[model samples]
Every structure is written in structure tokens, then in C-alpha cells.
Target chain A: MTSWQIIILASIAVFALKLAGYLVPPSLLERPRPARIANLMTVALLAALIVVQTLGAGTRIVFDARVPALIVAAGLLAVRAPFIVVVAAAATTAALIRLLT
Target chain B: MSTARSSQHKAAIRASVAVGIAVSAYGISFGALAVTAGLDIVQTCVLSLLMFSGGSQFAVIGILASGGTAAGVAAIASSTLLGTRNALYAIRMAPVVGGRWPRTLLAAHWTIDESTAVSAAQTTPEGQRAGFWWTGAIIYLGWNLATLIGALIGNLLGDVSQYGLDAAAAAAFLGLIWPRLKSMQPIAVAVGAAVVAALLTPALPPGLPVLAAALVAVVVGLTNWLGPKDPLPAMQQLDLGEDGFP
Candidate 1:
């Protein structure tokens, strides 16, 4: 597919996705099951996504110094360090790893 | 008369822009990387603008580069699945919008993970609504602009892998998820998913394992197999007080 086609398709898909939110009756959101699913889904999906992004890139875990960055990021997060710090620790760790290895 | 409320909103706008700038910088890396992966500049920018979801975009390009049609579908499916979480957030935020259609429209447009977190953390209703709208808008604008800029510069950037830009997107995702592990259940889910995905990384494509992991998370959550002792007390109580920002 051409770039335009991909863009158009994806845009339409996203709009449709957003529309679901607007169209759903607010009452449904009040239910315990749906609310439970919503809250759990964020953490669940996020965790899952991070795993795929970090470890699964076509094969073999890319566990080099990058893993250490995650370790530090998790540690900072554990301490409830500021958001900026957590991000910086990860980015800086990765950057240093790239520079060194 | 609520000067504090107005000021907090102002701070949210600025913070959103900051996040926008940071997140958009990665777009340059993505754009540059996509070009190297056989995507023309236009294709790269289009993915950024329309899909607007980083994980899925990376999955699509990665699959296409590897000649994997299924990869594209898997990536899109997983992304849409993850993106669905934003819809739930929208539902939660709706009441705070106070039935203002125009504001809702804008809120709907800009709603994303980062903006939602900020808005959800606000203590007041007005603050929540304002934070949601302003943050979402600024991030959206910044992200698109960054994508365009990144695409333009991508042609000039050679071998981004040397700088580890290839993994930068993943690294950013780590930053996003790390802050959310507030309890044992979340941490366990994260570790479990990561280990499983890592184990399956070689057997699967870039995005499939992620989709699988998400499925696992949902199942685990549904079964209540393990995790914190259900902090969601009064799950349906709608006590706007506790809802007053986490």
C-alpha cells in the first residue's frame, strides 16, 4: 500500500476507535466489571507492551546494559521518584550503553 | 475566584508541552529509522500522524521490513487492543467535562496515556477537565509536528542503530510503564509478561508476543489468580472523593 493509503486506513481506524468512547452510554462505565476491567487493563496492557517492546524484537532478548536501565527505572519507580528522573535514568543508561558497547 | 485552580491548569498545559517535546523527539528517531527500513518519508509521516500510536507503528514497519504480512496485522491488533485502554479513561473522564460538547470533542482528540495520568491526578473537577484538554491538545500537536520534522531529517540520518535509536522507542515505553507498578500484582504481571515475551521473542515476531502477553494479563486479572488484595475497594462506589486524583 502507498503511504497515503496506510495513513488513511490508520486514521479511519483511530477515529472509529475514539468514536466507541463517545458512543458508549456513560452508564456502562459505572458497572463494577467494566470498571475493574478498565483499571486492570491499563496496567496489564502497559506491562505487556513494555515486555514486547523491550525483549521481543524479532528474536533473542536484547539484554545487554539496557536491562540495567530498566532495573534503575524500576527502582526509581519503586521509590516514586519524579517522572522526569525515571525517564532520564532509563534514557541516560541506554545512551551510555550505546556509547560504551 | 479559584486562582489556585487556574494556576494548576496552566501548569498542566506547560507540562503537556514538555512531554510533547520529549515524545516528539523520538519521532525523529522513528522517522529516520523507518526510512532505513524501506518506508518512504511520506509513509513514515503518515504512520505517525494517523495511527498516532507508537507501539503499533513500530510493529507495522518492523513487520513490513521483514516481509511479514501477519506481523502487520498482529501489530495493529495489539496496538488497537492497547489503545482501547484510552477509551476506558475517556469514560472515567466524561463526567468531569461537565457536558460541554466542544470541550469533550477536544478532550476526545487529545486523550492519551500521559495526559490521562496527569488529568486523573488532579484534585479538582475543573482542574481535571482542563488538564485533560490542554495536555492532550499540546501533546497531539507536538507529536505530529515532531513526526514531520523527524521525517525531513530522517533522510539525513544514517545508521541510527549506532546511537541505539532502534531501541529508543522501547526504552521510552519502559519509562511509561515503570511508574505504574504501584503494587505487587502489577509488578508480578509486568515481570511475568516480560519474561514470557522475552522467551517467546524469538519464536514470534516483534508484536505478536506483546499481544499474547496482553491476553495473559487480562486472563490473569480476570481469574484473580494473584496480585494485590484488590485495592479497588468500592469498585463501583463512584466516591468522587477517592476519585479525586491518584
Candidate 2:
């Protein structure tokens, strides 16, 4: 399928998912187990995304500029730096590493 | 309206607008990175408009950038999985946005993190409505405009890696989810998932590792359910007062 088709289908799916939330019985959502999983899903998926983006390159895990940049980002985040600062710091760290090397 | 009530409403508006502008700064990066990641200007804008969720859009683009063989499928799956949280958000927002189907549908379209956070922060239903609509409108406008500007700039400055825009995707993702790691359980879950994905990258396909990592959450969730009762973690509390900025 083409990119546009993929986007269109995904758009419909997303809207359906959002709308389903309103339709689902509150009893299901209020359950402790599903709620717990839903909460952790964000953290887990994001972590997986970060790991893949930073370390993976076409099925090979390699260390590169993103590793240090991510370290800087994690540190800034640990300190509760503003969102903009975290992005700028990470980008600058990666850019400077690339420049120096 | 009374002066005090008017002041409170004004404060909610100011807060919502501030969140909108702050969120838009990330949109500029998303726009530029999406183009660099092989999406056209129109595709990027449409993704932002329809998918309408930053994390999911970034996930899709990130998969594409990583050279996934089935990039489209991977993108959609990851995006769909990441978007499930919006359903949870909608559950919390349903009571607050009670109206006819048309209004509720519009509210559902706007049921994103920032809008939900701002609306949940309000004390009154009116203020909640104000917060939700204003944040949604400003973010929609600001995000699309920034996306256009960034895409134009990115298209002009081809080969975005020279400026380290390549790493911007990961950086942006980190910036987004970092604030939510307020407690140990979430941190542990993130660490565990990262480890699982890192280990699985060599053996599995591009997207499967991410999907596989979700099992860790499922296991944890199930264990929590079967085990003795424990206090709710910060993440599960859904306290908007501490949600901070978008």
C-alpha cells in the first residue's frame, strides 16, 4: 500500500480508537488491571522507541552520537529541566559530538 | 459574570494558550524531522492533523527512519498501540464533555494530552470546557502552521543530518515522555522495556521488538492485579495538578 493509503487507514483507526473510549463501559475502564496496563503502556512503548531510535540501526545495535545525546537528555530530564531545554541540550550534544569527531 | 469568576476563567485561558504555544515548539521539530524522515509536507501535516497525536506520529516516522522493511505496517501498529492512551483520556473526559453526539465527537477529536490535562485542572465544568476547547484550537492552529514552516525550511535544507536533525526524533520522544517518569515503577518499566527491545533488535524485525516490549507491562499489570493491593502509582493517579506542561 502507498503512504497516503496507510495514513488514511491509520487516521480512521485512530479516530475509531478515540471514539471507542466514549463507548466503552466505565466498569471496564475502572478495572484496576486494565488501568494499570494502560498507564504502563506509555512508559514501556516510549522507552522501546527511544532505545530503538538511539541504539538500533537496521537490526544492528551500535553505539553512536545518540547515546551521549540521550545520556544528556536523561540527565536534564532527571533534573526536571523544561521540555525545550531537554530537546536543545540533546540536539546540541549530538551535533557537537558529530562536529568534533 | 462576577469579577472573581471572570478572573479564574481568564487564568484558565492563559494557561491553555501557554500550553498550546509550548507544545507547538515541538511541532516545528516534528515537521522538520518528518520531512527528513521521508514524509512529504502534505503527509506530515495530514499526520499531525488526523493522527493528531505527537507520540504516535513520531513513532511512525521513527520506524520509517530506521529502515523497517514493512515501514508502513510498523508505523501504523506502533501508532495504534501508542494511541490507546487517548482512549483512557477520553474515559476521564466523557463526563466533563457531556453533550450531543456532534459536540462529543468534536471533543473526542480534541481529546489529547494537553487538552485533557488543562481541562482536568479546572474546578468548574465551564472552565473545563474553556480549557479543553481553547487548548485544542490553539494547538491545532499552531501545530499546523509550525509544521508548514518547518517543512518548507527542512525541504530547503536537505540532508538534515548535517545539523543533527536526524537525532531530533529520538530527542523529541525523550523530551515528551521524560516528565511522566515521576516514580520508580514507571522508571523500572521503561528500563525493562528498553532492555528487552535492545536485546531483541538483532533477532526480530524492526517493529516487533517494540511490540514485544509491551509484554513487560502486561506481565507487570497482571502481577499487580493478582498480588496484594498496593497504593496507586503516580502514573495511575491521573492527577492533572502535577501533570506540568504539555
* Top of the candidates by TM-score: 2
**Looking at candidate 1, what is the lDDT of residue B153?**
66
- Best by the DockQ measure: 2
Candidate 2, residue B155: how far the Cα is off, in Å: 1.9
Deviation in angstroms for A61 in model 2?
Answer: 0.3
**What is the CAPRI rating of model 2's predicted complex?**
medium
RMSD of 2: 2.4
Candidate RMSDs in order: 5.1, 2.4
In the range B1-246, model 1's lDDT, one tens digit per residue, is 689878877876766566555555555555655665566787777677666665446545544443334355654565566566556666666676635677666566555655666676677777777667766666666767766776676567655445444444454456556545556665777777777766777787666666677755676667655644643542232222211111
Model 2, total clashes: 0
Extract clashing residue pairs from model 1.
Answer: none
TM of each candidate vs. truth: 0.73, 0.92
TM for candidate 2 is 0.92
lDDT of each: 0.59, 0.78
